[model samples]
Target chain A: MSDTSKKEFKRSFSGYVEICENMPTGMITVRGDLNSRKLKSAFSKVVGATLPKERKVTLAENSIAWMSPDELLIICGYDNVSDLMKKLQKELDDQHHMLVNVSDARAVFEVSGAAMVEIIAKLAPVNVKTLEIGEIRRTHFSQVAAAFWLTSEQRMKLICFSSVADYMFDLLKTSAVVNSKVGEF
Target chain B: MLIFTCPYCGIEADETELTPGGEAHLKRFGPGSSDEEFEGYLFNRENPKGVHFERWRHVYGCGKWFHAARCTLTLEVFGTYSAQTFEPPEEIKERIRAKRPGWKWRNFS
Candidate 1:
């Protein structure tokens, strides 16, 4: 066989796997006029309030509703995906609002071990200790912008762009192992 | 570390990506001020312990400035507002009234 016919592409990564036991986390983007009280009211009805203390259904356990003037990015448990979308759509019926379903377009990683904070700090810029309980933030993940929902005392949900999901997953897993010191909190 | 919740991005950014400028949206006095007044306006910093207000730049995110408050001891961030269209939230006003007793927000500009 000629060299041209037997050419091979160099592998950047060692081995590739089709499906990861890793299930994707749910994500949704909501946009509308934030100054309008009625619009906010409608959002409150759909996704509950910006504060969990004022609402019933929690997007994530102990998660806070972080909002801007025109946009709200909501993070909920992966299981309640379909129901939340339907509820949001119904709430904004005939209104000037949009809800884009991005659940499959992002990767979700639940970090909840004792040293989860330390592990995360290695990858992101924000100090885990500075983040209060029930805080939701849309920040960057190693140069890639992401939204984080601090779901519990120990649990944090990270949502990032799907195209880089595999890269992020690999980076996080490796960093966690190196940073997670044995017998240390 | 101070975190500024960006009004545009809705992300609470780190102190690393920000630069704190004492107060937010202050109107500068041109060549029409006294020496003492100018010194106070230009150099003095209100280093309050309980609730100090500071402006920050979201350099990496929106590249806009916003105001944020924090407790020196507890470091609890109560709220954040934008520099251009920042209207202090009512929740904060109520808290200040309750905590500071006789203190009032004196606005000159």
Candidate 2:
């Protein structure tokens, strides 16, 4: 509960588009056998969020995004993360799984506008033109590991390591320069 | 500019998103082995011009290690497979032979 132990920083860059840092969010890394019926049902009970398909996200009271073949990230309210983690542990105690609270290890951001696709294209190698709703793209921005998904229409939510938040913010700001839109997407 | 599809994640990742992990399916020869055998294991490597299988890590994405089979000269990717094998799969080898018939990769022919 002390401010000195916190690395709280917020910044915004409004150019041809709006780019802003998001508040801290709850993220839990759940790695296990995703094909298990018990894991699926327990996830629904713990957060009421379904287990998402590969490279997709399930949006409920809490959102669950598939990070890899056997890894899913459960996103909930930061204050409720511990409670949810305990619930998940109790639900799947007998099953083989690894659960870790990664809320403070990442920084989330939002880039919204018509040219949001082009802004991401400037840094990543992924083609977002055909990205369906709730589809996640786990790619790197220039040199750092990052992932993003379309949380809603015309709004993309991105997450990167906390240590690279400043660098990612600068990349987002530079890519969102006025009139620099490539218009390909 | 080579794009490799990660077998685990099922995504075609650009070379920038991947980190090459040298050749794949290398058998280790440690102590008690003959000098020639250990030397061959550590120093010798296949440099086939037609089909070569190598290891790659999808570091920026799923962070899984997978094997890729491709040509050393033309840079054409025959296919990509999992890294959980001591040898390329039979189907992958057959596919490579179909592309470059009589292509011999070390003793794999």
Candidate 3:
């Protein structure tokens, strides 16, 4: 195939990758159901090499369980996605868990810096303060069904369904940007 | 929004995610049991001050149903656990009363 033809095929065939301009976000859903025991073991193994120390785990320096069993719904830096997913896949494969790559099934975004909760509450219904650090919840932002995971007080990660990803990203970014501009003055 | 803790989701959602199944941890009996035995298990509750476990649905979130513990007097929450976690405690388990009782339910399933 010619390079030009290959490029066209690649663009059309890339079904799972979705990008957002305002927040510079991307998303994917990995499907696997693991009970508590299996989840603990799998998470420990997968996160082991990345942090690989008891001290880090105790201090919660890197990763955490943002939700309960059956689904983990991880959050990581956009640049680290390839490396993170590769490591996660290896761990799932080792455990023989049924891992389905649904990366294309959702939209992801990074809402960071201070005042993140105050900003998100304009759309989200639940009280953000009640969500302890390292917890994840499936809730609605505005009318959008979304799953949110907090990596830190200043940073939160959210996933909206793929079909509405564009709408959600645009809505959130537009509001947050407008608010940031207001704060700047 | 009401503060409701989902056992499966492990957090208090906006009451929107949870379908309130009424009081948590009620006990029912099978058909084989005697009328009085069945009644005892069917309807009885202790008005207590300490940990009281109740059931709730994570309908909007995980869709996994579970129970939560709340204090009657203080309203202090103990913890939330899956409905499948263990058998309902003996105290709250089946036996009905002839006097004023709880609400009616068509399907316990």
User: Which model scores highest in DockQ?
Assistant: 2
Model 1 achieves a DockQ score of 0.19
Per-candidate DockQ vs. reference:
0.19, 0.76, 0.28
Error of 2 at B54 (Å): 0.3
Question: What lDDT score belongs to each candidate, Candidate 1 first?
Answer: 0.59, 0.89, 0.53
Rank by lDDT (best first): 2, 1, 3
lDDT per residue (tens digit) for residues B13-56 in model 2: 98999999998888899999999999999999887767898999
Tell me the spans in candidate 2 whose CA falls farther than 4 Å from its real position: A1-9
TM-score of each: 0.52, 0.94, 0.54
Chain B superposition TM-score per model:
0.74, 0.94, 0.59
- The sequence of per-residue lDDT tens digits that candidate 3 reaches over residues A1-185 is 23332231111111112213223232224345544355456566765423222111122323433334454444433355566567767756656454434445655666666666765676776676676555566777776677776668876766677688767866666566642433321
Q: How many backbone clashes does candidate 3 have?
A: 17
Q: What CAPRI class is candidate 3? A: acceptable
lDDT of 1 by residue, B23-109 (tens): 654556559888877887787666555666667777645456777755555677767776765446677666666665554333411
Candidate 1 wrong stretches, greater than 4 Å: A1-22, A44-67, A76-87, A178-185, B1-109
